[model samples]
Target: MRLSTVILPIHRWAEGQKIWRRAEDLGFHAAYTYDHLSWRSFRDGPWFGAMPTLTAAASVTQRMRLGTLVTSPNFRHPVTLAKELISLDDISGGRITLGIGAGGTGFDATALGQEPWTPRERADRFAEFVPLLDRLLTEGSVSYEGDHYSAHEARNIPGCVQRPRLPFAVAATGPRGLKLVARHGQAWVTTGDPTLYENGTPEQSVEALRGQAGKLADACAALGRDVSGIEKVLLTGFTPDRGRPLTSLDAFVDFAGRHQELGFTELVIHWPIPDSDFAADEKVFERIALEAPAQLR
Candidate 1:
């Protein structure tokens, strides 16, 4: 399985660039940053725009693919986001991936004073968002109208550096969202069951994560899509308490092994920070970087 790391945009731009370059130097296959106006729990903390951060990251890293953890329709219009994505892909030399999800009901949802949506509404909005994005990226010009979004004469100039458009790593947990992944995504990303994580049962959470992987396979089958072509990514570094858990190198090896057994092709975890959400020492990552790959394989 490929290993990836997420560097939160809470740091300064220079520091962020250093992390991106270091991720590539450390043999990480990909690197990402969370895409949100402000994330939950850290809503009041330093948060930067994903586009600028990723664009700057692309300029620093050469080999490691870069992308947002997930972008949503909450604060983005597909037309504009499509343009920005193509530009990012061009700047990255076609090494950009798009991780997308239905907007959550936290800071991003209400940050602009928009009305809060129920779960069903969020799903519906996502349903409309993905296809429109796909069309906007692939087709030269798009004019479409839907319940949640509309694009009029939107033009994608020069298109994407990646032939059809940059690969989409869509996040999905429910059936409908999975169908969207089957239809449009080259990769699938899951955070597993938050409830299990909050309960502080890593074993149970791992089992639940495996079940979710199975569910994604079933979703692909139902849609007559080949499961092998769709990459699977799992997020494992999140903590139950708002603080990061000190993960041993051996523990990470087991975590990677379990997810690989579930057919996940990639594993993503947050970079260690001091006294923060993913709080841990940099040494933990150093150990994993040196030992986990050989052990897991």
Candidate 2:
């Protein structure tokens, strides 16, 4: 399976920038980042906007796919989004993947000044939103009036560097979400839990991830899409202090094999970017960037 590293997103924005540089130097397959207005997880502080950061990352890296792990309609009007993405595609020479989703979590919508809707509603809204964006990116012009978005001769200025539109990926986490992933995305991502299970094994979390992968595989076949069209990724890697006490890498490799069996062309490893108040924790970013490529290879 191919490999990519999550851009050190949580905190230390400058350090995250450095981590991006290091990962590119090590030859990771792609550099993935995300946009989130708020969160107080292990990684915290001001979050850099995805597209601009990607544009900056684009300038520095010569051969890595750049993407927002997921983008949403709430943050951008379709036309405005296409404009920025077009610029990015041109700047990056077509090396961009557009991963998108319905806004997740109440906190995200609250930040955006919109009420949080149920997952079903979010999915339905996305179904409306993505096709239009997809159309604009591919056709370079659009005319449509929908319940969510209306476009009157929307034009994608100068067009994107990637020809027939960029690869579309969906980051979903459930049954209905899996259906969305199958229909629209060229990639699907899963989260990894580092906690030991009741059985004193990491297998439970790995199994959960595998189960999600299986559902996506079935959904892809049902929807008449090639399973290979979608790449599957896994995240939450924190396996550093192994005294043969519990190798995290083993679990990660195991999960990859499972997802590969279920039809994933590539796996992007995401690491927790710890609560960045400490310098030590921040250093983990460098380690993750360095080690990910070796394992992926």
Candidate 3:
């Protein structure tokens, strides 16, 4: 399985860069940041917006990839967003991977001057965005027509240099979302313990996650894609307790391992990554960075 780490930037803005450099030095596969316009507390620090920080990160890291944990479709137009992903890909020698979701929470969208989209609208917008992104990043020109966006006169000018065209993935939850992954994306990007049952039981947790992923398999079969070839990628973040006084780290690992056995390709770890600085709450960040990797193993 491929292993990667998240640069859970806490305390100061400088730490984000420091973490990226360290991730690159440690030979991690990817370095990702969350898409957060603000947070609950500790509002002060040297923070970097996901896309902007990546431009700088691209210049700094040689092998490690860079991207957002999940950027919202409302944040940018499809073609424009494609440009950003491709640009970063070129900067990183095709090491960039995109993680996006059917954006929830209108907070950032409102903050960015982009109107928030409803769930159905978000999905529809994604449907528009995906095809447009594919065309922009792959072909030289695109003529797309959709509810939220349409493009008739467009050229894939300065397109991404990657072979597969900006190796994109979508952050997915629930059955419909998972199936979407199989249908259009390179992989299914997820966060949290899919195992489900927290205060409940293992059977409950397993069943919930299984039911969700099962839908993806069904979706793949319907689309005539090889269901067995579908790659599973869960981005684990929940801090379930361990076994003993040390909290054996059982929650995240076993939760992941169950799905890993189910055939996950990669499980990128970005734990307790506050949308903003947690200088007073850096332990969550530190404990996760230092101990989470061990748990993943």
Candidate 3 per-residue C-alpha lDDT over 42-119 given as tens digits, one digit per residue, 9 for 90 to 100? 235444567777777788788877877777676667777777787778778878877777777645657776666667
Against the correct fold, how does model 1 do in TM-score?
0.95
Model 3 quality (TM-score): 0.80
Task: Supply every candidate's count of residue pairs whose N, Cα or C atoms clash at under 3 angstroms.
Answer: 0, 3, 9
Q: Would you list the C-alpha lDDT of every candidate in the order shown? A: 0.85, 0.67, 0.64
Candidate 1, residues 1-297, lDDT tens digits: the string is 888888888888867778888888888889998999998767788889999999999888788899989999889889999999999999999999999999788888888998878999999999999999999999999999999899999999889999899999999999999999999999999888877666667677767777777788898899899989999987666534222333677667766776688788888878887876677778888678766767767
Error of 3 at 8 (Å): 4.4
Q: Please rank every candidate by lDDT, starting with the best.
A: 1, 2, 3
**lDDT for model 1:** 0.85
| Model 2 per-residue lDDT tens digits across residues 174-273 | 6666787787677786554334322334446556666677678788899898766777765434322111211344544555555566456666655334
Candidate number with greatest TM-score: 1
Q: Cα RMSD (Å) per model?
A: 1.8, 4.3, 4.3
Off by over 4 Å in 3: 8-13, 39-47, 112-115, 174-176, 192-203, 239-255, 271-297
Q: After superposition, how far is residue 59 of candidate 1 from its true place, in Å?
A: 0.9
> Lowest summed lDDT over 10 consecutive residues: which window, candidate 2?
238-247
